[model samples]
Target chain A: MGNLLRFEWRKLWQQKSLYICFGIGLAINFLALLSAKNFGALDSALGNMCVALNSGYTSFLGIYIALYACQDSSQQTIKNIYARGYSRSLVYWVKYAVSLGVTLATALLYWGFNFLLTCCFGGEVGSFITAVGQALALQLWVIIGYHGLFFGVAMLLNKLGGSIAINLIGVDCVFVVLSLIISLLKIDFNVMYYNLPNLLTDIVEASLMMPEFTSSMVLRGIIIPVLYVVTFVGAGWLVNRRRDV
Target chain B: MNENRQTNYVITTDNLTKVYGKKTVLDHVSMHVAQGDIYGFIGKNGAGKTTLMKLLLGMSQPTEGKIELFGSHQLNLGRAKIGALIEAPAFYQNCTAYENLQRFAILANAKGQDLHALLDFVGLGNVGKKKAGQFSLGMKQRLGIAIAMLGNPELLVLDEPINGLDPEGIKEIRDLLLRLNREQGVTILVSSHLLDELAKITTRYGIINNGRLVEETTATELMQNCQHKLQVLTDQPKQAEKIIKKMYPQVPLLVSESGVEVIAEDIDSGAINRALVLDGVNVRGLTAITDNMEDYFIQRMGGNNG
Candidate 1:
């Protein structure tokens, strides 16, 4: 098991894109903070605010990281990993570990930069620390759901471009448009399973954006995506068992 | 309770079958590979060679039948004690040869195979930092063999190992596999469309066509059972083939783009020439065909697929 992790760690690191994407992710987070630097107290207040005023920035990873992680699956390298003596479960976890490490680092950098921006704008470190810590913690569950979701998408489709189109363009964009159109009717299906991904985004947004948010909303909001991870993980396993590797 | 059920063979299958919805990909198929013999699985394209390898590798579940590997019913045994490269060399193309081997060794359970020693063994020693993606096709193929040798696997299964290799690379891989078989006593199962190469090294041949075993025999018996043809490019080759088949119906005539082979016993070029002329067919050229494995394989699986 230790050997398999070492093997996958070495394997994942060999792709220069991993580091390139890390550098890019860190840069995006840093730039998000830098963009708010000159806004004086307001920008800093937004930075100290539960989430980035530019909450949409988090979606950058939705596109970049999703495609980046799926690249190995697209190229059939993960299949090669299975050819190695490790069990399918082992392969999933090693990829999970490496991908989590990278995502955690990126999330921390995002949190750190927001904290810096908060402090720069005359906000107390306490609020920044608490809010950013809570936000980052919530991001972990989101990451888990995303990880399982993308692995299933990538494994089933076996193509990064196709998976991205299906997930981001088809699923996310379509749901966003539907939610916007339904707003006039005052019908809120956005919180329904039909718009689960949007619900994840809305949940995160609500966690950070609420004028007075509590820990319970964060926990409750995470429940659906966690369930999603379980469902997709089981689906991924079934697909893997059946896929012609 | 049944000691005879467990044989010395490292790999064996009984009537394996695979079906996809409406299509039967692999029909009832059965074959055995012994502990030490270099078994060659020969078949044409889409003959379900890769499917069979995948089934034994536990990458795919068979729709019917069972496969035993390394003296056990563990479908995943092919994952351990056995190293395999199916279809093509699938390493992290971005990684160096050493790193690729390190992964396989880990899967095979090793840090690396005395790194420097294996580099020299596969003749990739001088390539200090060349990533597998940057290496030429031949270099990648050699690295693949080195990767397979990692953890000192006792059984090696290679599907179309020499698929895209150049002549030099083909010879290099041939020699490398031979060395592993001869010195290391590693049992190898190599599937290839190229029969001549397999003819030189394979101790046993398993001819597969449309997912059924047509023949399973030793290289020597293949030579003895099949007739040697004197390939003659005669104007009346059709007439000559008729006469030959009339005399020897068992030895089927093989016609290629180059010439026709009169499947008869111990017939010199002179006899073939005389027979063709007397049969009113002008003989252009006559060459005695060697009783080789390629000839045997072509004869066995050529039209059998259709």
Candidate 2:
């Protein structure tokens, strides 16, 4: 299993698509920061940077995971891993771990660059140090949920273009429909606010815009995405184990 | 039972079958690949050669029956001892030949093997920085062999390794396989439609037709079964056959429209010509038509599927 992980890690790192995805992530954050610096919103630059990073990574991570992690299935390169005597479950986990690591690294590049920009151009760090920490932590958890969701969709669809389309279109439609229903009803459904997209929006607000953080809000933010990770990744693992490839 | 099975055969399958929907691809295929033997698996397209190879490698599960590899009923455990390149060469297209092998070597736990030496063995030593996607079909096939030979496995199962190679590439692979078998005594079960090329290196042949193991025989046995007949085209074939049969009643002779086919190992054509001419049977032409591996396959499979 150790060797397989190392093998997958090396293979994953060598892909040109992975580097391209990471570059895109960095560019989106850079452009957002450039805009904030130009507009002279120096006091609120940190909050804008955090929201931009969160939104950019959340949208792109799914496509990145779909193209890079799901590539082996279309190329049939995963057969070599299994041909080396590793079980299907072990192969799936290796891919899962390596893909998760890659998505995290891309996320860090986006957030890390924003951190430097915030320190250089924005207000003093001592004022918003705790907020920055909370935003970074919440973004990390949110990215895990994206990784799991995209990874599971990739395995289930097992095609690059198809996985990307489903993740982008399918996930957006669900969130949009749910939000519309909640707005129309004008009901006080506290659980609806803790859904994935809304939960991520709440996390960003709590971290930067909002002054106080409720215990329930923080707890829901962590627990909900964690459950998303378990459900989607578990489903993918089950399908991959029985798949003939 | 395990001891007896392990001492000889490296691969044994009993009544292996695979079905997809209503179509049965393989039906009751009981195959045996002996230790140290270069077993040539001959079949037409869609003859279940790849299906059987997949089952043996555990790439696909069998609908019915058992497969024992390396003397163990546990195929997954025994797969570590086997090296295979089924269907096409499955490798990361973006990775170079050396990079691909290094990655697989780590996964295969074959770090002890020299990476450069294996590349050079397959004639891909100087292919530095050239990604596998850019490689020609022949080069990809050679790299596939290098990858398979990485762990120094005792058994090799390759499917159509020589499918799209030039004459030079074919000879190079043939020599490499021959050397591997002779020097290292590694057992090979290769499936190829190129019978003549496969015949040059195979010790034993397994002919599969319509998902059935039609025949399994050694080279010597196949040689004996090949068409070895002396044709004597004469004006009076009937008279010539009578005279030849009268002299040698033990030799099997078939009289045809054009000539008489004498099925014998040692026959003096000069003596037969002299005797036929003396008997007023005008001998126009006489030639020997011998059957090779290709002929034997055609005869066994009941003609070309084409």
Candidate 3:
């Protein structure tokens, strides 16, 4: 299992797409910082940058997972792992762990750089630090949700255009469309508000408002996203384990 | 268990069948490859060679029957002791040949193996910092061999490893396979359309047609069993045929449009000529014909399907 993870890490790290995704995240954060400096908006910039990073990090992570899964399936590189006496479930879990690992690493580096830059550029840091901490904690669950959901879709679809398109369009839009249809029809599906993507945005907004981090709030953050992660990952694992490479 | 162990067979499939929906791709293929034997698998395109290889590699499950590798029917444990390159070698296209092998070596838990030496053995030692995507088809093939040789596996199962090589590339790969078999005693099961190269290297051969293993024979047995006949073209061919039969009733003679073809254990042109002249039959042309591997394959496969 350790060797499998190491091999996956090497393959993922060697892709030029990794650098492109990281570069895009950095460039977006840099542009946000420059605008905040120009407009004298440093006081609110940190919270706003967190929101942007939250979306940027999750979307980029999804794209990376989709691309990696597509390449592995299309080129049949997963055979390398399986042919070496490794089981299919182990390979699936390794991919899941690696995706989450790389995503967390990228997010932390981006957030740390932005936070340090905001402090250097005279941004307000009082109490916002605590809020960002709570938000980061909540974001971990949301990140897992996004990775599991996207990785599952990639494994299920097992193609370049379909996986990426579903990750970018299907996952992002299907929930919105369903929610809008519910609203239009006057349906009372309150749980829709607790979906991981929707809850992520709400959590980031609450962090901006500097709300109290209650135990109920923490439970809500962890439970909903964990459910999403488990449901998607469980379905993907069952299907992929039986699939012939 | 003792019987399987004493047989010395490296791979044996019993009634292995693969069916895709309504189409049966491989039907009851029972094949055997012995240890220290270079076995050649010959078939036409879509004749289930790749499918069988996939089954052997455990990439797919068989619909029926069993496959035994290294005396074990349990695929996972047996597969660890085998190296394979099926259809084509798959690697990270963005990675260089050395890096790709390094990653595979790491995956195979061959940490102490010298990857550079394997690269040199496959004639790709000078390829540095070049991504596998940029490699020509032949170079990619050699790289595939290098990758399969990682971990120093005892058994190799390669499918069409010489598909796109030039003459020189073909010879290099042939020599490499020969050296591996001769020096390290690695048992090999290779499938290819290049029958000439396969003929030179393989000690055993399996011919599959329409998803069934039609024939399996050792090189020596095939050579000994291949049809050897004497051709005689003569004036008054019917008369010569009657005379030869009267003199030598033991010889099996086949009469054709222009002459008589004789199938006998011991054929003597001088004795036959004198016997024919004694009967006033003119012998115009006399020649002996022996069938090689290619001819035997054509004959077994019912001509030209290969």
Candidate 4:
């Protein structure tokens, strides 16, 4: 298992797509920072940038994670690993762990850059740091949950194009349609409030407005994403353990 | 258990079957590949050659049956001693050959292997830096073989290793396989559609038709079963046939397009040539013919189909 993890790490670093995705993220950050003055205040600029990084990074993260997850199957190289007698469960988990690690790492880098850029553009460093610190836990969970969902789709589909399409478009469409149905039915219970996207928005909003997180906010944030992570990773592992490569 | 201990077979399968939906891809294939033997697995396309290899390598599970490698049923542990190249040689196309091999070597924990030496052994020493996607089919196949040679595996399961090679490339791979088997005593189970190429190195053969092991025979037995005949190309075919028939009345003789064919083992060609010349029959040519592996395979498949 250690060897498999090492192998996955090496493979992840070797992928050019990882760097391309990072480059796109960096470019978007620079663009967003360049337009920071239009928001009218340094605090508002930092807050908006925090929200965008927390929520919008998922698009790039989803695409990048999908590519990483589906690479072995797309290139037909998974057989090499399996032929070495490694169990499918081991391979799947190692891949998930490595992808999750990279996703979190990229998220940190993006947040760090956003912090530096906002401060350089005259935003208060203390406020920027405080805002990031408050939202950090929920931010990490949202990234993990979304990564789990994207990785699951990639594993089940095992096609580059389909995985990317589903991870980016199909998932958002499902959530949108679900939200629409709930709204039309006038349901008192808003399930979307606990979903990863809405939770992300709520976390950003609450972090900007409130001084500290209430226990209820923290509990809901942790519980929902953890559930998403467990459900998706478990389902992906089950299918991968049985499906023929 | 004692029987298994005494037997030197490297691979043994019992009633191995693979079913996809309503179709049975492999139907109760029980095969044995002995140690120190270059076992040739011959079959046409979609005949379950790759599927069987997949099962042995643990890439796929069998619907029914058992597979024992080196006399043990713990396949996952046993498969650690095996290296395989099934279907197409898969690799990270963007990575160079050396990088690709290095990653797999790391995964296999083959710390002591000299990647440079392995590349040289596969005739890709200088091209190690070249990306695998830029490589030709033959080069990719060689790289695949090099990767399989990592960890110095005890057994090799290769599916059509020489599929897209030129004649020279094919001969090089053949020599390499022979050297690996002869020098290092690596047992190989290689499947190929090229029967003639397989015939040159194979000590044992398992002919599979429609996912069934129709026959298993050693080289000597296969040679003996293949037809060996003496032919006399003559100006007077009828006269030569008559003369030969009268000389050896019990032998089977046929007048073919080229000459009079005497289908028999150990024919005294000198005596027949002298007798035909002495009888004033001009013997244009005298030659012997033996059936090749292709002919034998075709005949066996045809017979099985019938």
**Candidate 3 lDDT tens digits, B105-221:** 987778899998888888899998999989999888888888788888889889999988999989999998999999999999999988889999999999998899999999888
Counting clashing residue pairs in each candidate, in order, gives 0, 0, 0, 0
lDDT tens digits by residue: candidate 3, A1-245: 88889988988888778789888877877777878788987655457546655546666777788888678778777776677767788888898888789877887787777777777788765455676778877887777787888888888888888888888778657777888888899988964666666778877877877655667777888888787788888888988877877
Alpha-carbon lDDT, every model: 0.69, 0.81, 0.82, 0.85
Clashing residue pairs in candidate 2 (N, C-alpha, C atoms within 3 angstroms): none
Model 4, A1-245: lDDT tens digits are 88899999988987888988888878877776667556654554456555656535877887888889988998889998888878888899899989989988888788777777776777765554554566876778777888888888888888899988988887668878888998899988777766677788888888888877788888887888888778878888888887886
Candidate 2 regions exceeding 4 Å error are A43-53, A126-138, A177-195, A209-219, B1-6, B243-253, B263-288
Clashing pairs in 1: none
Model 1 residue B209 lDDT?
80
Best by lDDT: 4
Best by DockQ: 4
Fnat for every candidate: 0.51, 0.58, 0.58, 0.75
After superposing candidate 3 on the true structure, give the runs of residues whose Cα lies further than 4 Å from its correct spot. A44-52, A128-133, A180-186, A213-217, B1-3, B247-252, B264-270
**Interface C-alpha RMSD, model 1:** 2.2
Q: After superposition, how far is residue B207 of candidate 4 from its true place, in Å?
A: 0.5
Across B151-257, the per-residue lDDT of candidate 1 in tens digits comes to 88888989888877888778888888888899989999999878888877888888888778888888778777776667878666567778767656777678665
True contacts kept of 2: 0.58
- The worst-scoring run of ten residues by lDDT in candidate 1 chain B lies at B1-10
